[model samples]
Target: MTCLPKCAVLELTYQCNHKCKFCSCPWYAPNSSYSIGQELNLNQWKQVILKLYDLGIQAFSISGGECLLKDCLPDILRFINEEGQTRGLRKEIVVISNGLLMNDDYLQLFKQNHVHLSMSLPGIETFAQHTGVDNANGVLHWFQEAKRIGLNTTVNITVTKKNYYELFRTISLGLINGASSVLLNRFLPGGRGLIYQDELALNKAQLNCMLDTAEEVLILSNRYGFVGTEIPLCAIDSPEKHKHLRYGTKCAAAKDFFVIDPAGQIRTCNHSPKVVGNIFHQEIIEDKEYWNIFANSNYHPTICQSCKLLNMCDCGCREVANILHHSPSAVDDSTELYVARPAKP
Candidate 1:
């Protein structure tokens, strides 16, 4: 059993400027943009980062309602780089933003720090409406600017029934805007998405069609020189079309990835609220007690136990499995139904 290395995700602030209807964090605590708990100060965050590095975690991604909301983000990045350098440890830093608050100055800072940017652009008008951001044009403008400044850029777009038709257009936009890659995510049933579940959620057949379209778009985008990466589960849904896509690679979250909330609570992934431990109170990686949490939480899905691609698929995200079965231990059958033969070498 190869235990995957870990990557750290720091949530600078839970305060987001735009209220996207599909946002899960917002739904976790309604009536307020900020979390009820105290936000981690500079020193506290520094400790968390340093501790993670000491625990053998090297790569990190900073996100939030909008990571830019934190005034200390630059300082935080600077500290991480400096500390990492001191230890002779190479670290990759990434930030996921809505592209609403970043400007030329911000871009320069990110470039100077060697940070990769993952920007979110839901879709066209339909996505804009869902996020309550009146100016989708403004978001696109920054995306182009970020690329111009020589910053590596990736686009994250959520797929839903409302914007399913524009899937190709969105991929095209990302490529045109110089996005190195694009992430097509299925609309998870949580947060603001819960209200519009009926309107935005896709049935089994509809989801299959969407996955097929995604594969076609990815092929077209790659042909034109754009690197396209689809969400694991979505790609798994249409294995035949995405057969060229690799499987059996360890998930990013399971390997070299972790998410820390604004208050410094760390978990395996953002979608999971299961708090493995808090960076503020404990060094989760070094503490065998905390690491055991994940060990006890089985990764192999019951349905996938006998599947040839069981290791390849990892039975999709744990959060997704729980959603389908209404229990943490329940296995999702969707992956089994959608599994297909791997592409011929």
Candidate 2:
């Protein structure tokens, strides 16, 4: 468990331009995300990246309320790109943005640095309903433009009751237009998503439909992609059927990757509000005890302890469980929503 993770997400800033109803930035929630001007500046952020690189973390994801809102972003990207070049290392850098601020310069920078870019597309026809803007076309256009300039792109989709039916079409539009791959996250209520939970949440039947649609599209398109969030293995209807989708099972928090907020606080994952420690103030290895919780997390949804798929699933995101019931030992909300085990594959 003392071994470092492979990727680190640096949330550059909480400032954003979009007002999507499903915004997951911690600031939009009941608790304040950070002090108004407490976010690390360009030099401090540079220090963070250097510290991470020294810790042997080679991949980084630059994200935000909207990353483009950070004036230091271009500098941060340039710094990472230049550092990798100077070190003769091919560090992986990914930027996930809302796409309202994407432009040619950013695309070209991503192309030159080999930074993979992902754009969040909530839905096609109902995109305006979620983001308060009818710019889904513009997102697709950004994909086309990214392709034209030779940058790798991904369409990041967050599925909820609001966009459940349009899931497949959204994938098709992105892939056909120019997205090289897709990343889907079935909504986990947190931050702003918490307030609108009832209106945006997806149930078991609807969740299955979305997965079914996603599986078909990936196979038919023959593209490379995977789901970005964890789901219960038992809830998955067919083990063989969903195996190819490569979404998530069990939990990868603090294992495969971790998140660092704008104020330099380490979180178990992006959705997790828990801060393990700050990288600048202390050595990350000093906080191995905090990561132990995730490494040795309890079986969520007590029933998962006896399920045949116990080894393969941890009863979905514990973060969701914590958010809903506010107890570390509580079961995931999906446990109640999905009553029966998915009839074994």
Candidate 3:
């Protein structure tokens, strides 16, 4: 476990059924140049789980445009469970999905296998606007059912300008529906997100507003959660105030985990198009240089290196840096306008 990644995100496929405007998938971009890659077969996927477990990966996050689109997921989960049981290792599995396809049968199967579900929510009435899906109400119903069925479910809200004002109300509804915890994410420009950046991206003022709303809502709900996106310490007026709010705080990409796409290529993280290497070819557990690429070596500057908050902050999304500045290590835009701006009282 010392040299290995503690978690590995295994993307089942790139094909998703929803036209979520904020989707970062490159192929989802309008007039996009990228196309879907070939997915790992059931047998190949079983091999992936086996190798990942051997590499001491403690958790496997199953995701895709929509993972349920894959016919072999149940079998793949069975493989993961069987592998964990056989090796007597503490293996964790969480499925990141839109929750549209999760039927009762799938729910029972997930519960039986000890799977955690991170379902995307579009905020109270902003669902149709954000997801381009009309069944927003159904998403909440399924979330409540999952929690009732005894699944550790997380309500994932991707904050955009449209849903920004509804942040608190959204978290409240999710909590009322029995969400075990809540996760907040700010829209980062990339892939399809680039096409919608002007429409969805939040500004510094909005980011501060979100932090205030999130902190207040979490305190009121008394739920266990955090804003799951990497935000720079300098972006917030007082980063210390959010300690109780539980910000994602630091970038955990290569430090804690790495992402593997459908073609077996490893990315710095899911939003990053920079493929580190194929899981079949890379020495993930032993390669320190590979790990260094995501440690913000290129993004951090002299000022950042000298800052006290440097260790706890990654400046912001490395993918955002790479996308906007063409340098993965470039200073985060969040910290560019001001160095430690003040938040509203």
Candidate 4:
């Protein structure tokens, strides 16, 4: 509870090109009066990275509405890559993008810096439906190019009601196109996703089917890796069944990770809208007190208090719980929609 974070998510900009229905950027609200309009410039980003490095955070994940949309992204990447080289630090850099803006230069920077890149691809057939773009094929081609260049390639598939059925095809396509891994992300009904939950959120049966498909894919394929993020442990088969699968029983929030928004405000996690403090305004960087307080939090639903899998599931994502239940620690009783506890328990 008193340690530094191993990784930090830095939102370089709130500006994005695509208008995906499930876009979860916390600051993005189309009709809202307030938004995260202020963004840190390239130099400010460099300073923040240096401050994080000084605080012993070795790994960083950079994102944006679309990180590649930033004109100075190459400069930012160059700064981070050059600093990593000069400091001789065991730096782990990752970039998450929609893959629409991916180019040879971006690929070159990734290859030059050992950066791991994950492109968001709901499904090739349904890309336009999900991302409001018809360039799925083009993005896949870019992924192949990135793979050919020896960069770590991954695809992020957000499983929603619209794309749940095509989950396997999406994963298969990504693997066939030279992706080393595919991440099946759960749809958190926060930020923009909150507004589209009725149309996008997966019900219990769909969620199970998605997990089942993912498990089967993992078992059959040995070369490709599949990870389900923010999935309830109870929704999937045992961890022993899949070697590459990763799921969190509890929310990482301020525990294992923290997200820095575009304006330098630090949230417990990317999905969490709760602002703990700003990394620059507060002494959060130098000390672990801010994270420690939230790390030790124990509030939970009454139903979870006696469940056998309580520790294993942590009642799923607290951010989603907060959106539905009005408290991060409360349960939505939507187990019928996702998971269920034993009758006797």
lDDT tens digits, residues 139-178, model 4? 7898899889888878888888889888888888888788
TM-scores for the candidates? 0.82, 0.92, 0.90, 0.90
Worst 10 residues of 4 by lDDT: 28-37
Query: Could you tell me how far off, in angstroms, the CA of residue 12 lies in candidate 1 after the best superposition?
Result: 1.1
- Clashing residue pairs in all predictions, respectively, total 5, 0, 3, 1
Q: For residues 185-224, could you state the per-residue lDDT of candidate 2 as single tens digits? A: 8888777888788888888888888888888898898875
lDDT of 1 by residue, 1-345 (tens): 224356777888878888887676632533434334678889888888877787777788899868999988999999988888898866568888988887899889888887888888788768667788775676677778988888888777776778878877877787677777766666665555656766776555665666666567668766222222213343345455564223322334444466788987666667654556666563444434434434444555555455554445544445555545655445544232333333332
Clashing residue pairs in candidate 4 (N, C-alpha, C atoms within 3 angstroms):
204-337
Off by over 4 Å in 1: 1-4, 26-36, 223-238, 243-255, 283-301, 323-326, 333-345
> Poorest 10 consecutive residues of model 3 by lDDT?
336-345
Quality of model 1 by C-alpha lDDT: 0.66
lDDT of 4: 0.73
Q: Measured by TM-score, how close is model 2 to the native structure? A: 0.92
lDDT (C-alpha, whole model) for all candidates: 0.66, 0.80, 0.77, 0.73
Of the two candidates 1 and 3, the one with more favorable lDDT, higher being better, is 3
